[model samples]
Target chain A: MIAENYSLTGKQILHFETFGFLVRRNVFSAEEVAKINGEFDRRRASILAEIDPEEKRTFTQWPTRNPENPFTASLLDDPRIYVPSEQLVGEDSIPIQSHCNSYGKSSGWHVDTFDRRLCVIKNILYLQPTTADRGALRVIPGSHRSPLSEDLRNMDLYGFHDDTSPFLNASGMRGEDIPCYIFESEPGDVITFNELTWHAAFGGYKDRRSLSYNFFTNPKADDEIESMKKIVEHTPANTQGLGTVGLEYHPNWLENADNNPRRARWINWLEKWGFTDVLNN
Target chain B: MSMLTEQQITFFNTFGFIILRKVFSDEELAIMDDEFETSLKTIQGERPDNEVPKHFNWSNLGPETPFLSLLPEDPRICETAEQLFGEHVIAVSSNSNRRVGNTHWHTDQSHPHSYGLKFAAYLQPLNSDNGAFRVIPGSHKQPFNDKLKHIEMHSSEITVPYYSCDSAPGDIVIFNFATWHSSFGGSTNRRMCTIDFYKNPETPEEVEGTYDQVIVDEKVYAKLRAYGSGFHPHWLANPQNSPRRQRWIDWLRKYGFVKSEEA
Candidate 1:
């Protein structure tokens, strides 16, 4: 559980603004992290049993806001998560995406999106101890800003579009060897970054557990709304029969939203933006 | 001939640093290493037992070491500096150091308009966990450069993330003077040397800034004082008598960094 008086400091807010990322340690207690780990394992086991008898190197499914994982869903209401999210992205920011990942292989460097108008931040929780050589997230500080962001976009260092060639522009080094800040973390720590920041992971075990929560600043501008529409349209539905299959949000998540004022507001925003259309079709 | 390619220059401009692998051959490195050791011993004397780990340095491009004094005129070093800072760049100073563990994060030059570069040659193998140079890429530019000032203030711990420039004996790491950089987890007596160069001042403001820098910058002032007369007599005498060295000497004398009558 979060401490009663816990809140992000002004210095931390400035750090996030300056560096494009922030790390808060022990945001969740040991007991809370243990509960999260247990919930993650249960979800993973269910997915594995039904499909993919041979385990894949990575498995990602949305575990938040689901009726089966009410404890995890309530994280949206928890001040430890929402308070900082509000501070960074404004109080009206809404949840855009959630993922619980079981990663086995190294991830190459890439930003989540190049759409500047989207304005999203991701808060990630590792369910295990992570170090530089053990699957920690690495980020290029201030790479989220323009020109550098545009430059990295042009480099296509990770070969996101062309799987045939990778690390083409990595200055003769492997992805892991690229100079970056490795977010070495413990289970209770939360690492947050702008979605446009360049990030990667390397040297991880076969079952490195991570939970990610993405929040987007509520659209007020025309361009922002348009960007939101594009995001909603382009986001592929999770069809792996794991969590929220063939839908942008799970049905139980919407059902649970009615009771929570903050969740309801977020759900209302999603509905207004046509996020529910993916389920309708 | 220019030692740096267009792509390498671009990398330096974009990332605030670049490592040129094997810039010096093994034989060349052996000579440099020998000179560095001899000069350190000659100037600072033998290290005492249980000496407190600290960064030790003395003037490098001076008459005390004839071979090292001429390094500024070496085509590989000179041409690279020219490529980065233009043909008229000023050779600021050079130093050989026995560095201790964890030099904290900072820019050698913090002024927004400051245009200078440092070429560091570490004579020993180093990695992230062993005193390798680390930098936050692109931090030499505005906004990013200013944003990194916090690291300078809170430098005791490696709070911010950085890219480690793990290097070998013959490698050279060239970086912008404003780039935020540090080394961590190093042992005492990590052998290294550096040459600093600045872009030639064109405008009146730049000239005044350069003069002010010479007077106000602690490192530059310290270096000048350490050289006794601001330059070695042999170095001032232009022993090799190269026109390039003559030009630098003339610039130094004109700027009042050296006495005109000393030579």
Candidate 2:
């Protein structure tokens, strides 16, 4: 059952507004983490067996439409994630992307997006303990705001200039040496961050396991609706073969909605956007 | 009389760009060709990091060398800029580029205004079949601009009808900073140079807007040792009598776009 008073405190809200991210320590219980890890591990093993290990691939939107694991499916209504998401964005926010990642190499610093209009926040859960050397998330606080965001946005972070130079470094410093808050975590700790906030992982394990749920503010204006449509069009088919059929979400998650009014609001919006036909199909 | 005609001005306003045929004389064109070669060697010689990409570029190429220094104040350039941007215009930055392969469609800056523009001249002939400059006209405007930009970012195959700016050596291409542009087919050694200019701010808000853009432009230089001052030392040190250039330099220095020590 959802917690009775599942809400973020005023101080936590202020912290998120100031830094563009928050860490909710031990949001998932040990038992919950174990169950989530077990489900993902079985899926990862099956995925790995089907692919060449030498190719070193990663899977996104894992176990989303899957119905075999009831515990993972229940995350949709989890008070810990759902409550904080509602507090941060709004009741109208809906999950747009999900992933269970095994990265091939350390990722360079980048914002989830360049546009300022779209508001997509990602909630990441680490299934294993993580450190900087083991590829914990690192962020530059308040980087999502203007001036700082503007500066970072123009740089050749991915080396279009062949500079290979670390971005946002006033003086020459290695990308790892730039000042940042490392999200060192034990299993079950949840980190939620604005998609626009600059983040990177350095020196991570090849099999480093993490799950992410991306949620976005519901489109209200004409421009926001267009932006949302573009995001949906660009999104590839998920593991459940949901979006591939159309912009329709995972059919299984829709079927499980039943009497949940909160999920119904999102479903209504999706149907308006031509995402409902796949459910019947 | 203005260097550019009224129809040319209207075309520029509508499409966010215009190509001025033979803007430079044969002598000036030859000097530019020699200076570009010199600049390539100069940048390579001054490179502090070998890891930096071999396709080199350095800003404010104007004051660094003589023939290039005369470009900003040249009547052909200054008069046309004044016509569009108003009486108080500022030369922001100038640079040389040695390009490689294809550049996907994108705006240099996405700010929804005509505050800044770039005038580029390629050293060699180019066509759409050979890596010619391409642009989607009227893409600097709102709502639709954003939508087209979104497609440019998301999709690889660009199906929109785009104007290919096939050019010879003397042709000058001027475009708004927000205009969506790219080059499709090109060799690795395609050489080009551009001079950036911005409208002089009439209000504090406009001044701040200019400040924000300067910060964005300076991020490119933040990684290099030679670019320690953001602007080249020559850009700071070279004395100019024109109140227009001086006023702009003072504003940049005051706002920290120019290094304090260099100022």
Quick one: best lDDT, which candidate? 1
lDDT of 1 at A44: 74
Off by over 4 Å in 1: A1-3, A56-59, A155-158, A161-171, A236-246, A279-281, B5-7, B45-56, B99-102, B124-130, B150-152, B155-158, B184-190, B202-205, B217-219, B223-225
Q: Go through the candidates in order and give the C-alpha RMSD of each one to the true structure.
A: 3.7, 16.6
Give me the displacement of residue A108 in model 1, in angstroms.
1.6
> Per-residue CA lDDT of candidate 1, range B75-157, in tens?
88988999988999877677777877788888887454557898899999999999999998888887788777654346332
Interface quality of candidate 1 as DockQ: 0.42
Among all windows of ten consecutive residues in candidate 1 chain A, which has the lowest summed lDDT? A160-169
- For A1-281, candidate 1 gives per-residue lDDT tens digits of 55675566777777787778988888887988989888888877776777645876354555465666667767877888888888889889987767677876777778887889867899999999999889899898888896667666655565432232244443455666556788988999999999989888877678788878889988889999888777776664433333443244678878763588888888788788776665435
Q: After aligning candidate 1 to the native by TM-score, how far in Å is the CA of B248 from where it should be?
A: 2.8
What is candidate 2's lDDT per residue for A155-201, written digit by digit as tens? 43432111354342333435564335678899889989998887887
Candidate 1: fraction of native contacts reproduced: 0.37
Candidate 2 per-residue lDDT, tens place, B1-263, comes to 77876546655665578887788778888998888777667766666753335355655444546777657767877778888777777776666777778887788873444378888988889997788888765555554356553343433222334567878988999988777788977887888877777876677777777777766666655543233343666666656666666776786676666767765
Report lDDT per candidate.
Answer: 0.76, 0.68
How far out, in Å, is residue A200 in model 1? 1.1
- The candidate maximizing DockQ is 1
